[model samples]
Target: MRPPAPRRTTALLAGLGLLLAGCTTAGDDAGPGESGLLTGPGITETTISLGALTDLTGPYAALSTSIINAQQLAVDEINADGGICGRSLQMVVRDHGYDVQQALGAYTEIAPSVAAMPQLLGSPMLAALLDDLAADQMLTFPQSWDSTLLGRPEIQVPGNTYDVDMINAVDYLLRSSLVAEGDAIGHVFFENEYGENALSGSTFAAEREGLTIVEQRVMPTDQDMSAQVTALREAGVTAVLFSAGPAQTASFVGVAAASGWEVPVIGSTPAYASQLLETAAAPALEGLFVMVSGAPAASSDIPGVRELVESYQSAYPGESIDGGVLSGYGVMEFLAEALRIACDQGDLSRAGIIAAHRTQGLVEGDLGMAMDFSDPNRPPSFDSYLLRPEVGADGGLVEIESASRAPAVDDYTFPTSG
Candidate 1:
């Protein structure tokens, strides 16, 4: 049976609401940074520093390491090519060891010393430091996608943070699939706040589609998942929307397929990363569906795409390129644009960088989607695409097929970089 017309409107709202434009915390006027070119109060003789917090020792190490490499690649590339402004970028790295208090201590240490903060990565850790960063006036470049971080999930934000990831794969199911009231959709989410935010959207989206969700399974970051998979199978779920990373995602897919639980799987952007899937064994994730807010690996058609690819390969020899590389490139794109804007405006201030991003929308020549930080918007990305993760003859996520028609730039509205 066809979905009713009224349900279509609700689905659209769900999609828009999930886009997470300024949905988290209260919107702030993010001022610019201190530029060496400006001979003023904030300007200093030392190198302009951009620090980041890493879970270099914890369960999230693989992705965390990737995030750090990606961010650092941007930093190293910028520094090599005359750096951000005339001042070189000094990376102040800290390891959180998967501990929130450790992460906070690192944040506290970096807050006063650096011009900007670690576009902080990881779920609970980043959310844990949200209020401190806001109160201390540190610019952040976060790598986590947990929408609840905008409000409250597990690690309560001192205040509402903008939840950009309020939408994920579930949006597609509600709008495109045939889920009805009698059918139950099974969901599994990580215990972290980001995982909850990602999974909760699935629940709400399933309900909006007139579907009854019977089983909700939650797992800690380090727990084994054989039981969760078995439980979902017993529950008679017709489909699944998940909040897991590549590793757990792989485990679920492998077990689901082997156990004859053959439901089509759908997940947020994190599930789509090629490196993550590859790390988890490429063949294990074949035939899975994923939705994320960026284009596939850097395409050749995009300007500067080749340079980025070459730079990434050169930096990490023998390591296969992953989807996370685009993010590494984007951070630099923002940093460089901020520098250019600071130069043109004759000052490097936090507000200046915000003005640059808001005014001169820097079209991502390489990373696919342009980063947007508009006057009323702070969720820097919303360009999402859908794909099926099928293994090629080469044993990799060989061929990608985009489920959407919008180009990377057209997918999102960038702030004017005037």
Candidate 2:
């Protein structure tokens, strides 16, 4: 089915309008007034500082950089428009190098210095810091979409979890007749929360679609997936769903091709990395599909998306806009809504921001869909777009289908162990 002409959802228009409004003279330049309420740390009379603990020099460095850039763009724009509640929004970033101990140390050092943390990069690292964060009632914008984070009110993941992505991917395959009922479907996962989250969805789909799921788990450090691909092929699987990193993605596709195991390969969001397109495995990745929660950066039909693309292009001329960049931009939009609501309530503190997030039920912006925070424990959206890879001068993953929402996803319970 063809996707309808992209409608400028109210959320999209409102998000851009709010950002543009910041550029106008609408907010109170006097900043949040002294209400004597215990606002969280990091808010001064003139500025609201946000901390970002990232993986700048780690395995996921490229992704971390994109997110940082997007967040910076939002901050710059917000600051130019007079900032939130009359105070400049500043982000204090720390690179943890994807090490849990370093991440904990970074959080310890910066915990007392910010009003909120809008970017906590690693799942394991974030998990290690959760206790400390909760003790201080600190609000965080985590990068991982693991369902476990949903239980923490202070941690808000901007997009759906890996489980939701798999559910939709499976549904797409079945609906499109690429796979039949009872066909053997294999899953190559990382064996961690990120991988398991995706497996949970695929498992759910299998139970509903009557497909057999052959599981193959790998460690986060595993770079070669030849053995796994060989096993899946022997099992006579009709397709493979992946929940691993970029290197693993390349390895799986390249190795599969070398072994002559041709099957539709679908990956969760984290499985995609534009950098893979430049690798020796690039040719092997042709025709591979991945799930994307938001509209791609290439889709300029939405006004907010257009603004983001233009901003990124001008700022980083010639740089590729990938999912990481798009995700980072989305995060800021989510933060902006929460901050705006808090400022309106005359409380720019950490507690104030949390309260604002809970009350700001549905926020429509350029992020993806209208995000609803009415229940922080639930996913913001269960739908996704299916993207297929095309190599060469005009190569990139193009959206072949939009608005693919699976019933299995909608019915799947949150915080399930896989």
Candidate 3:
């Protein structure tokens, strides 16, 4: 069972204020006077520093690059608009290269200086640092969406968890008649929290729909999917659910096509990369589908989405755009809201920031869904958009279904942090 939520008592606040006061000298600028905003490590008189622990040189480089760029764009815009709480927002980024060890080292180096982290990528990395993060009371938005990371006040998942997305994927497949009762389904996944969490959903769906799941677990370092595909083909699966990185996606699709296994392939959001459209696997991706939390980056229907896309295109003329841009920008918007609320209460300290975040009842932003941040134990949103790969479409994906939550999600039990 999870522990009780931390109380924001006057004594707790006072202690944190005193501790922070000693950290910043009196020569520093005054706090926001009206609210008695007590300044903390990342908050000075003129700037509020946030940390970004991202993957820039590893398997997720392409997506992480786009995410970081979007975050930078958000920061620039926030600063341009006279900043937040009379102070400019500064994002300090460190590349973890998708390695757990490197991620830990980067967090250690930056945790002392930043008040909060708006972007920390990778499930394994976040799991490794979960205890420390709680101890530090660092409000973090992890790029990973595993259910096991839930029930922690300091860690906020930006969108639906992997299990929730998988449940939705299964629901969509069943509703579309891609798979039927008693049909075998192949589940290709990594041997980690990410894949395991997704597997939980698939298993639940299979039980509900009278289907069988043929599970094939692979490590992140495993790229070739020949063996897995052959096994799935032997199992005579009518549909496939994949929860892995882009490399595995490309390989799995390519091998399936070569083997003449013409089944509908559905993957989690991180499973596809825009660069794959330029590869031999591009043709094979025609049978591929993905479940994501946000709309396409170039979507123009929503006013907020359109504005972000226009600003991004104008600011970065030649850079490629993807759904990561939406995620990066949206997370920053979420963080900025918490900061603004904290500033209003005159408490920029770490504990104060966490306290402020809990008060955000319904956070409506340019993102696809309305997030309820009031309950930190629950996921922010449980909706997903189903998209398919297209050769020339923006972000190499075309939305087949808008954002919607599956009925099964209402019965799904989310895992608590251990």
Candidate 3 CA-lDDT value: 0.80
Better of 2 and 3 by lDDT: 3
> Per-residue lDDT for 1-418 in model 2, tens only?
1111122222222343233223212121223345532244777777888999999999899888888987888788778877876788899999999999999888889888787788998878977888787766677888887876786767787777788888888888898788999798999998887888888888988998899899999998888888998899999999899888888889999988877777888987778777778878877887555544544534535566666767877887777777777677777777776777666655655656666666656666654466666566787666687776665321156666865588777678877321
lDDT of each: 0.52, 0.73, 0.80
User: Residue 122 of model 3: what lDDT?
Assistant: 89
Location of the lowest summed lDDT over 10 successive residues in candidate 2 = 1-10
TM-score of each: 0.74, 0.88, 0.90
Between candidates 2 and 3, the one scoring higher on TM-score is: 3
Taking the tens digit of each residue's C-alpha lDDT, what string does model 1 give over 345-385? 55444433333334433243344454434322334444455
Winning candidate number (lDDT): 3
Which stretches of model 2 miss by more than 4 angstroms?
Answer: 1-38, 292-300, 391-395, 416-418
Off by over 4 Å in 1: 1-43, 148-168, 174-182, 271-281, 289-293, 298-306, 351-365, 376-378, 390-418
TM-score of candidate 2 to 2 decimals: 0.88
Q: Sorted on lDDT, highest at the top, how do the candidates line up?
A: 3, 2, 1
Error of 1 at 195 (Å): 2.3
